[model samples]
Target: MRWAPRGCGGTRPSPEHVKRNGWHDQNILVVSPDDQRLTWPERELVRQLGEKLYGTRNISEDRNG
Candidate 1:
């Protein structure tokens, strides 16, 4: 399935935000069954949208990597 943001192309998730939050190279634990079902691109879109709307560190990253 192709996922696109309404009125425009979807945004891309940036590792920069994670790095800025000092979470780069850290393990992020995402616990969403539905989200997990999405393809890699879709998951990325979700992450990107979340970061864009809510700023960095919106999603928690697991530090045990």
Candidate 2:
């Protein structure tokens, strides 16, 4: 239940992201970013946040679960 903005690759970014990601994370419960089981919202938010943070829209749930 965390958000790292893709390339940021950190545990938890901000409290807001934590809250948002956490909400979705529970559904996904990714042991790592490489696991795949994220919800649609989780995936969308991650991708959006990733692009915002990394200046690229490459956030992928393909790796995260």
Candidate 3:
């Protein structure tokens, strides 16, 4: 599956974010920002990165995204 943030209008993660998050572009990692497996800083960074790449979620688009 393609890698995209869950609530960020399906924008793909940046290469920098991928490496920082220890992910490869072809890897599929679906985790919530609140996932217990992630540290607080990491979760926060995920949110920040999602926002940086996609601004914010569009409720309308989310129905299909």
Candidate 4:
């Protein structure tokens, strides 16, 4: 399951939903500026890391699988 840090202010998929889909990893994606108010360089780093781990697809794309 993917989750950004707190204060991101979005409706996250419920843990039960993720569990029903068999995704149990606590995969935290640093995709929000609210996470430490990341600087440009930090954001870039997070973006690269996220791409490496989760790929560049839209999150919805993964839902079908």
Q: Which parts of model 1 have CA positions greater than 4 angstroms off?
A: 1-34, 58-65
TM-score for each model: 0.36, 0.33, 0.41, 0.36
Residues 35-65, candidate 2, lDDT per residue (tens digit)?
Answer: 2577766777776665666676454646456
Pairs that collide, model 4: none
Model 3's TM-score against the true structure: 0.41
Identify the candidate with maximal lDDT.
3
Which regions of candidate 2 fall more than 4 Å away from where they truly are? Answer: 1-35, 58-65
Query: In model 2, where is the ten-residue run with the lowest total lDDT?
Result: 27-36
Task: Write candidate 1's Cα lDDT for 1-65 as tens digits.
Answer: 48766766766557656544554356654423235668988877777776776675623666465
Residue 31, candidate 3: Cα error in Å is 3.6
lDDT of 1 at 53: 65
Ranking by lDDT: 3, 4, 1, 2
**Cα lDDT computed for each candidate against the true fold:** 0.59, 0.58, 0.69, 0.63
lDDT at position 46, candidate 2: 70
Candidate 2's TM-score: 0.33
- Report how far residue 61 has shifted in candidate 4, in Å: 9.6
Judged by TM-score relative to the true structure, which candidate is superior, 3 or 4? 3
Tell me the tens digit of each residue's lDDT in model 4 across 1-65.
Answer: 48767798677887657654553456533254225667888877877777787788465565546
